[model samples]
Target: MSTGELSDERVTAAVRDATAAPSMHNTQPWRFRYLRSEGVFQVRADFGRALPHADPDGRALHISCGAALLNLRVALAHRGLRPVARLLPDPGDPALLAVVRPSRPEDGGEGGGGEGGLGALHPAVHRRHTSRLPFTETEIPQALRTALSDAARREGALLDFPGPSHLRWVLQLVEEAEARNRTDRGEAEDLARWTRAGTAGTSDAAGAAAAGDGIPEYAFGPRRFDGRAPVRDFAGTGRVSGRRAATFERHPQVALLSTVKDRPEDWLRAGQAMERVLLLATLEGLVGSPATQPVEWPDLRWPLRDPVSGRGQVQTVLRLGYGPSGPGTPRRPTGEVLDIRP
Candidate 1:
């Protein structure tokens, strides 16, 4: 896999896989520039798509780009090339998140997981989705939970399954955040601007078909009629015609993803770790969704940390279990997100 040997089609396919990574509000706020001469792809943040109200510090934006970077590595490894990634290669340019190039396996690469293991996850990349629907009551096995934590550790982050007491407290924070969102004008506006309507009776993919970004109506799943699941109601105060109400799991299976230090680089690592955990869970017959409402609010976020340890900064709360896989959200075209230079 030399510089000149890497075909344009391969690069395009890799970028396509990268864009499949989830983001806040499904914004897909990332851009890729392939430098043929250097044999590298630069991952940059698209500030135009940034959620100012929800993520004013751009932490979520960087996390979204980091997930895409991980996908690029997985895609290259699946293609029989070892992918090497360098995070924040240039401090002068903050938006330039990472530089990734394909190398021979013998040449090695950064990150813990081997090329083989990463490639094994390529299939799961596209298979994983944010399922907003209700999940069953079955508890995840201890073995699978351990494996998911290992996946996060390999990416320089921590995924903690809170105890009964801690879990109840975290859920309280989520409820508080939800209450705030209802009254916060700025948060409401962000939700409205990024969410789509007019797909009430149509398929999940139909609402996103026009915008190529944002959460669609059908993907909102049923509104939480009862139960303790922390599903976000994208509809806000408005009503979606023909939408049904359902009770979610009473004790939803949840995990908290966090990093030791809360810096830009750490946020990037958290994002990669988050996606790795998600893809592995999907491969192991699980559907999941990210519940970031608590994390989005500064006051509510600090209380989400494990009271026992209280070590890491919580990045995102994840809900995982056996449930219907969420419908695929629309993604911006490859041409729109990628730029190739000679």
Candidate 2:
């Protein structure tokens, strides 16, 4: 674990772990290059996969890349390597989201150091899936909530669990955004391009497909028979084999992840914090799904803030509870998304 240099096989393994991070519609909008001479991992944005209508400003794209970066860090830490990461390291190249170098020194088990904690979260990287099914009404323990909040704070972001009144208002904003998304031709086209009612991978099975990326029908959880969990319905009215309708929790537990500033760098940080919290949640025996409906719209985004304090700008809506973990969707092969320099 103390070995400073990484072999090509180890680098490939790290990139595989990084690609496991979730993205909007499973676009996997990220690329990685291992500079062998510099001993650095460069995380870049793949603009070719950008969702023009859903994320015109590339905020979500940056966030997705940040999530991948977090996974890469975790992978390195699990191997007892110190990952010193910098966000937006280069001013000249906007596509370079992050540059991570493995420091030579071993991380002491000191409380202040991040390496120990990140290594602890290594198992959750592959286990954490975006669960869209119904969750039990049982409340999450206060200690667990605090832990999740701390995870977010560690990456310079805030996790707010709204009260009943504020949650109702937030739900209203989601409904409004969903309504707008249904009527907007641009959004519909975007969804159609990234979602598949039949197999999304290459196979011809019902929920299976040959494609390496995109949301597969098998991963669509189930239809919300009668709850306001705010889960995105990828199927819409489209048909999928063996899809079922199920009742969800009456008062689903949700949380809002936000940042103090609304900038590109802030979005990138939020993405890392989002993944951190999610991985911690998974470790604590929780399953979750992301609902970005209100956050995606300019008009509704402002109202999503705390009604009284009006503090941070919300970036992600998370639904968490005890539920079945959704099936994993295929990722673009590591060879396709990674390049190794001589």
Candidate 3:
């Protein structure tokens, strides 16, 4: 993750490990170019991969990139390279989300998660997937929720969980985003293009003819009340031939990632927290999708911040529960997205 003379092995390892970051619909809208001497990992937003209609303000795009950035950090850590990340280092380089100078644990010490759990999530990285499936009737342990909140807090964000009243507020917001999106022809078209059933993704992993990178028939579950119950319907148009509609759980746990300000730095922080919670949740056998439904709308965005705490701007909402993790979607390979420079 540095510039000057780092080995190709080191940079490639970081990029490969970072791809484990979960993206909304696996957009994976990020590419990294590295400068070896400086140990700088330059993150570029692949606007070609942007779902503009669904994420008009490009917030989810940033969050996805941020998630990738977080993965880069962990990958570096696991490789005995501690990472010193400078987010949005240059305003002139807008696509460059960060520059990481690799640091060894010998320098930065060990994890803030403690030695025991320093990389408790290392295994979960490859295993984590979006779970649109319904969870069991059981509730999540309170202690784990506290731990997830702690993880988010450490990344400069807050996860405001839903109570009955708060849940209602979010349901309405989902409805609002869904309603607006459904009626817009442009939005529907965009979703159709990005959510294709069997088209090959740009990533190497998606090249198999029988495989799928975009949302496929086997996924998409049931219609979330048409307008919105929860979960965005990726296959509502009946693209998948034999895919059946099934029931999701009666209720899904929801949490929001929010930050104090709405600047690029805040967004980067929120994104890292988003990745942390998602990875932590996966390590705990929980799976869910990022519901950036509120962040997509200006009307719903500001109100999403906790009124009392006023802690941070709302970055994302996540629907989480115990269930079958969604099958691995697709990822563009490191070879296509990662560049090494002298």
Best by lDDT: 1
Who is ahead in TM-score, 1 or 2? 1
Candidate 3: residue 211 Cα off by (Å)? 8.8
* Clashes by residue pair, model 1: none
**Candidate 3 lDDT score relative to the true structure:** 0.72
How far residue 266's Cα lies from its native spot in candidate 2, in Å, is 0.9
1-342 per-residue lDDT for model 2 (tens digits) = 444469999999999999999899999999999998888999999999999988899989988888999999888877767788898888999889899987644547311125337878888999999988888899998888988888899899999899999999988888798888878888888888887666633454333445778887778888788988888888764666777889988888889999999888898899999999999899889999889988889888889999888899898888888888988877877999999997
Q: Write down the worst ten-residue block by lDDT for model 1.
A: 107-116
- Error at 305, model 3, angstroms: 3.4
Over 4 Å off in model 2, which ranges? 1-4, 105-116, 200-209
lDDT of 1 by residue, 215-253 (tens): 888788998999999889998888889889999999998
Global local distance difference test of model 2: 0.85
Cα displacement (Å) at residue 275, model 2: 0.6
Q: For candidate 3, lDDT tens digit of each residue in 1-342? A: 223335788789879878878766667788899886666788788888888676776777788888888888777666655567888878897888888777645533533334334355566677877766666546778998998898888788888787777777887887687677666776677767666554323443345313324554445664443223367767644455545456566666788778878877787788888888888888888887877666777888777666666666788888877877776665666788888887
Better TM-score candidate (1, 3): 1
- Model 3 clash tally? 17
The parts of candidate 1 lying over 4 Å away from their true place are 107-116, 203-207
Please list the C-alpha lDDT of all candidates, in the order they appear: 0.90, 0.85, 0.72
Candidate rank order under lDDT: 1, 2, 3
